[model samples]
Target: MSTQTGRCYCGAFHVGTKASPQTVAYCHCSDCRRLSGAPVAAFAAFDPAHVVITPRWPDAKSHAKGVKRWFCPECGTQLGATYDYLPDQVYMPVGLFDQADRWQPQLHSHADSALPWLHIDDGLPRNAASSRASLTMASCDS
Candidate 1:
């Protein structure tokens, strides 16, 4: 794993990791697009504790599904996505990184929510609220 660093658009959020993630993914869920204010959102999966986040909030403002979306309360910047089901890992948005080249997407999730103009040629596992979503529920503490 290579070292990677990231911060929010306004520098309100900062994260550091030793993750040279090549198996990243594209997410096209409506919630994601709306939340990110972009065509799509992409992230790299990593060990939850491998990341050292500063300005840590005791409570993160979140939107929940099977997972929890944490945002910077001050700036409303989406910081990272954490699975209530998978506590051992979390997905950090690639765009937040100052050094983003090491992580390249290997798959696309929520393909059905993808926009018409956007095209994904990569043959990866896709979910229109798919397995990742399902697995999240499956792994839940219900």
Candidate 2:
């Protein structure tokens, strides 16, 4: 019920959401780790309508097709990503939150791609791909 506010590392971009996240996960996908420069990227997903994003720079880029990743022009801080595969949702890096401790990752996505040296013993569900990935094909049929 509480709102969450966040900004890019250099404060060039800002985002706020009043609605509860639709889902949260620690993603180990190669793209995520490469973009985040971390072993895992923890993010909270929300309906795009629920989030308000203000970007100081007009253009943000993504290497992946069908996905747009935004960053701060000033600091190049990776703010979030939106997938064309999931039009209803936006993924925000949990670390950007003003109070990141308040959020907990609900599961691990792309677990099969996780780094061999990095171990996660949090006991959450681990999916080879997003739990929602399987629903993608069916969703486009309607």
Candidate 3:
């Protein structure tokens, strides 16, 4: 498999993964929206073992139980996250990708928390919360 690469805005941090992402999705949870400063946040998840980080993040914050978000100290760029619920995966912000278009969000998650004014007309499945099943149904390799 071809490797995917990304870096923080200031180029202070970099990451690469040889494994294709397992799933890509738009997250509307409050933490995601607040941190991204957008109505929705998009992420592509891959096996943690396949992810190689340069200048590893020493500072991380857990906005809620089980989920830890890491940002670049130099640029404050939200780099990636890890969820206790999915211990085996690492979620990277799609915007950081060098080829962002390579992975498109197949679903909208945490739909119940979405802002009323935000309307995504993509026609993708909207789930009330984390939906691993929905991702599998989207034909993504587990």
Candidate 4:
């Protein structure tokens, strides 16, 4: 199994995964954009059992129903998230991974919410809403 490691912006939180991600995706939802402070947010989904966060994982914050997000207490960097619908997986920002270059997004979620000014002409599939089926299927396949 391939292992990946990364740290928060302030280096106060470290994350390690013993296995490769189940899937990687780009989310254009406003909530994700606001949380990441980016036009689009990319995340790598993995089985929570395979991941470990050192120095402790701070309590999660839930501003939206069914979604819980974790951040670094020291730097406020978004660490990871878990959704009630996708309870089997945890999503971590791809930018937080040291091997981010290897984890290219496979699809775009909430494409309808994408900002007009941001144009990613990648031919990847674009889901008008949450790609729950695709995402869950990927985890099953993994």
- Candidate number achieving the greatest TM-score relative to the actual structure: 4
Writing each residue's lDDT as its tens digit, candidate 1 over 24-78 gives 7777877778878888888777776677777673265445556676677667777
Q: Estimate each model's TM-score.
A: 0.79, 0.86, 0.87, 0.93
Model 4: residues with Cα > 4 Å off, grouped in runs: 137-142
- Relative to the true structure, how large is the alpha-carbon lDDT of every model? 0.68, 0.74, 0.79, 0.85
In model 3, the clashing pairs are none
RMSD of each: 3.9, 4.1, 4.1, 3.7
lDDT of 4 at 41: 90
- What's the candidate order when arranged by decreasing lDDT? 4, 3, 2, 1
Candidate 4 has an lDDT of: 0.85
Off by over 4 Å in 3: 136-142
lDDT of 3 by residue, 1-142 (tens): 8989999899999988898788888888887787888888888988888988797764787766777878888888988888775767888888888878879888888888889999889899888876766563111111
> Between candidates 3 and 4, which one is better according to lDDT?
4
Q: Model 1 — which ten-residue stretch has the worst lDDT?
A: 133-142
lDDT (10s digit) by residue, model 2, range 2-55: 788988887777988888767778888887787789988888887777788774
Q: Model 3 reaches what TM-score against the true structure? A: 0.87
lDDT of 4 by residue, 1-142 (tens): 8889999999999999999989899988877887888899999998999999998888989877777889999999989988887878999999999999999899998888899999998899998888887666221101
TM-score of candidate 2 versus the correct structure, residues matched by position? 0.86
Q: What would you estimate as the lDDT of candidate 3?
A: 0.79
> Which ten residues in a row are the worst by lDDT in model 2?
133-142
TM-score-best of 1 and 2: 2
Give me the displacement of residue 112 in model 1, in angstroms.
1.3
